[model samples]
Target: MKGQHVTITSEWTPREGERYVLGEGPRFVDGQPLIVDILSGRLIDSDSGRTLIQIDEPLGAVAPLTGRNGWIAAAGTGIALIDPDGVEWLAKPEVSADTPMRMNDGVADPMGRFWAGSMAYDNRPGAGSLYRVGVDRTVDRVLNDLTVPNGPAFSNDGSVMYLADSARGVIFRFDVDTTLGDLGPAVEWVRVEGGSPDGMCVDENDHLWSAVWGGSRIDRYAPDGTRTASVPVPVTQPTAVLITPDKRILVTSASFGFDQPQVDDGAVFVAETTVAAAPAARYGPSN
Candidate 1:
């Protein structure tokens, strides 16, 4: 399909309550919107502005665990399981402790394995890598040489994966072995024009929606890499994009780098849309 532009009015509404220093990872779990305050290491329920859990280090993203009580999260320098009792360390990737890196954007694939990426604190180029947590709880370094790795969003059937390297302004695609959690060669998918692509999600129509970190917009692209639509956001740093089941678009923004942040800079903003998202995947062996 050829690309077309769509308009979203100034009707974007920010969720009331607390603003985050770095708001990211907007997802729907059991029909409720959930987001993360990355810098503060908080997982929050977006609808009520309630803090679900708080970790000591940065919490990038989380996925509900199948047949389990809590969540599987990409936090700090590794992956961990967060439950009502407390946080249990899973596997920490072998990044040098002195280098100072943290986990970034991540999501559970359709086959229930979790994938996340890491980046250095100083934004050092070629100092980041992508990791995947298998169903057996083993961590594998999937890709290397990333700077600001933001996403590893998967397609509905888990046959295709899209990953974004924000500092490099590119998103790459990969073929996946869903049954075994193996990936094929990475192919350059999209080279973002105006802003760096941060977090992203795939919709029911097999279209990709990405949050433009410095461009103040959310971009929708067709499966063939054609830019289809753009949703203008009021905030400059739209960190992540989530499409709800009821066809509402949710965007998370960050206030971490601002000297004097705007009123809605760190808030979760929503707009009614006509496109719905694919069912979110959980992490675990049972699935």
Candidate 2:
């Protein structure tokens, strides 16, 4: 059932830091928010504005390794592991250089499998794909013929997955085979109307929260695919949303397409929310 509209304009305030050209992938790890400056390929601590690491290519997202002191990240053309030493490539797409695709949003599922999606630089239709990296470090193309794939958020028990095709303004739901990390059939879940969905996260109640790129808002959806609430954002482009463990909402924005950007256009914003989020799942063996 649809609920009353809740506008949250006064609660949001920008986090201290220099603005980002393309700020994205807000994830809470060890009680701190880690964000990515996508085009710059820099992963940063949102609170301190400290660069954790910067690579030569675009960095989409990262998840902490379960059994090691490092990170498994969706970067450039494939997935890589980052540590104090340096980055070691785990897998790369087989597509030729002429295709020119780069990784976008990604995360590790509750079962510790890493999944990432990629899109062509030119935004060509049907040129994007979603890949899954298993516990044994095998990369498999799970879905193809996508344009601007985002989110791919999962349910708490790893039984369901939700993915958005931003360019198509649609979010899809899928059943997951938890033991084998195989997806069942894709079902149309939500077709966004006003704004294209960007990045998303699932809350403790299994509700999905998405950052709407062009609508100046973040939307919350019930598990049954009903739009229940919407939180207004100060910036025009809210690239991603994270529900912090402390029950706060963290959003990353972008200044990429704006000619005269607002003061908070590319800033990270934080808000106090009633909902709580579980800690992100780590990549690798579960202890």
Candidate 3:
């Protein structure tokens, strides 16, 4: 059931062609909110509607996350750690530089492994894969031959992992082996008939809150994949969702493919939500 609207955070709009503000990653790390502007390489503060740092490099996903002093960013075909000095590539992607493939959405597991999904720039089928970065800094291609792989949110206990193939309009849950950082066979969790599921976040009660791209709304799902709640946003392309440390529900939107993008097309919003924050932020390596 849809609920009443709540107070929104400071409103901000994308400059231009800047879709999916949280397309890469948006999560609170150590009490600070971090958001990645995937196409522009803008590291936004998510508070003052300001850009804290901007790099020329384009990234598929940025884990508004860090192990200690640096961030884990999926650039081109590899994952890098960005800090005060510079960037360091921790793993090299398997595909060649010429491939039309690029990363999409990603997150860290409670065990501290970074998981990222990739897709073709032209939306070609079976041209993407999901990669896992171990704590030892090894990159492993776990899932292959996919299209538009989105969320990788985990259960509270880290026993289950929720993954999505948006082009199919479905999300899957997998049994996870936290010790080995491996994913078991996936079972259908939810099938969205209205809009493709994009990025997502897990709440305190083992429910999934996902952004419905092109649906102009966000939906909440139980562990068994049943719709429990929904919320409407001001944009048509709400790419991702997140909950800040202070308990405000924040959503990220995009402006891509819109003929004449409106003022709210690329805006990030705050809405009413009853769920608290997740058990803890995704794990990462120590300093």
Candidate 4:
């Protein structure tokens, strides 16, 4: 079946006393989506808006969470192990930071390591960082001093790691040392004009798909970063995206960033395509 984009959730639905501020990290597990509301640190079940789990911190601002066993690797802080009953226990990040939370978009690599990005809380450009956490609890800094470092997704072969710096409006490519859990010097992979790039994913064909926050669209690019096509959306702020295990395109959007009337304007959208999708990667531990 080809990939398709459609809206499955209502626009700006309220959940756990919070409306969708910034939506990122949409992952399909067990036939349902696990999503994070960035401003509130709430992990929600897409089908019901039930607060499945809560991050025990102030403004946790989580995005692109990957689940494995009982753990969730939350963007901004570190890995959060969610017990079977929906309680979260956080594992401290290996990289030290003055800010309370700095992580952004992340995903589990094909080799089972969690790759996430961090940026200065005050939105300082070029002060963000990236890290990799292995299943055995080993954490290593792979990149540093990024301005709004966000999405980190790997190619189908696991040879290339695509990292995006939102403030720079560009996505970069790095040579991945999978066995070492390391990333090499980044080469400019793709650039977008007038739009900030947020979360990203790799399709079955190894194409890079990125969500543009202000651009109201998702873009597909070839491995070398050539623009393939753009998919328009109803909401202006698209925070994260994923291609489901069955190849359905799921998008999480935001209503909080613009205005009050706009706060509930966001919606979780889906689209269908004939193309298939790669299986989602995994993270380790529950807490």
Local distance difference test, each candidate: 0.89, 0.90, 0.73, 0.69
Best by lDDT: 2
- Alpha-carbon TM-score of each model against the true structure: 0.95, 0.96, 0.88, 0.83
In candidate 1, position 168 carries an lDDT of 92
RMSD of 2: 2.0
After superposition on all CA atoms, what RMSD does each candidate show versus the true structure?
2.0, 2.0, 3.5, 4.6
Clashing pairs in 3: 24-61
lDDT of 3 by residue, 55-129 (tens): 666665665444465667776666777778888888767347356666777787877788888888887887888
Of the two candidates 1 and 2, the one with more favorable lDDT, higher being better, is: 2
- The lDDT, on a scale of 0 to 1, for candidate 1 is 0.89
Model 2 agreement with the true structure over 1-287: per-residue lDDT tens digits: 12433233347889876999999988899888999999999999999999998999899999999978889999999999999999999988834645789999999999999999999988889899999999888999999999899988999899999999999999999999999998999999999988999999998889899999998998999899988988788888999999977888899999998889988989999887766888878999786
Candidate 2 ranges with C-alpha deviation above 4 Å: 1-10, 94-97
On lDDT, the stronger of 3 and 4 is 3
Error of 3 at 8 (Å): 11
Model 4 off-target regions past 4 Å?
A: 1-19, 58-68, 85-96, 285-287
Candidate 4: C-alpha RMSD to true structure equals 4.6
Model 4 shows how many backbone clashes?
24
lDDT tens digits, residue span 101-139, model 4? 556777777776777777676887667778777777576
At residue 130, what lDDT does model 3 achieve?
89
The segments of candidate 1 whose C-alpha lies over 4 angstroms from its true place after superposition are 1-10, 94-98
What does the lDDT read for residue 238 in candidate 2? 94
Q: Lowest summed-lDDT stretch of 10 residues in model 3?
A: 3-12
